[model samples]
Target: MSDSPRTILVVEDDNIVRMLIVDVLEELEYTVLEAADAAEALAVLNNADQTIDLMMTDLGLPDMNGKDLANRAREIRPDIPVLFASGYADSVDVPEGMHNIGKPFSIDQLRDKVKGILGN
Candidate 1:
């Protein structure tokens, strides 16, 4: 019921994977922001002008892990939904209501998971 399209902040260090995810989310009719590392992600989260509806990050990042980033992002936007993506996601301790989709996911898999969180 929001007037603006839902916005997602995608954090992935892998260039190709990040691009693919961005493309998929855009096709799903969501506005997207992206970062290649935790620092950039933090900067975006710190921005007072942007409204991020959700965060989808790779579990393993070069600067800092996705969980930590999510924690920090929560400081900026409490209750922001989080989605983690990784091959080893089984090992992650995800927050309640948080979601995950493994790497190499099909377009449908990605769409379902993101739309489920965004409620689109």
Candidate 2:
């Protein structure tokens, strides 16, 4: 892999939640991009200059749902990894090859999940 830290695109409609996630990820030494909704997320995804290794999105987006956004993102970056965050995480049935984390996740849990997905 490249020596640069992995870049993560975080898509959460809630400004506070998005900021917290962005702060935590940045604290963990990863590059973070923020999007308040699916439309903004798509804008980032469509940007060829941006390097997004993984996407961490909330299932309850203001515009499109996380699954829809993930599908759209894949249309642009087919192999991009997706991590879904949901309040009902235990009941969420994420698609194969995708991952999910419960809302209000601890900092350790977030760190571990991202690390596991990114193979860190």
| 45: Cα error in model 1, Å | 0.4
Per-residue lDDT over 1-120 for candidate 1, one digit per residue giving the tens place of the 0 to 100 score: 757789999999999989998998898889999999999999999998998899999989999988888889888888899999989777777888688887778999999998888876
Model 2 residue runs over 4 Å out of place are: none
| Model 1: ten consecutive residues of lowest lDDT | 88-97
lDDT of 2 by residue, 1-120 (tens): 778999999999889999999999999999999999999999999999999999999999979999999989998999999999999999988887789999889999999999999998
For each of the candidates, give the backbone clash count: 0, 0
Evaluate all candidate structures by whole-model CA lDDT and list the values in order.
0.90, 0.94
Model 2 accuracy (lDDT, Cα): 0.94
Indicate the TM-score of model 1: 0.94
Among all candidates shown, the one with the greatest lDDT:
2
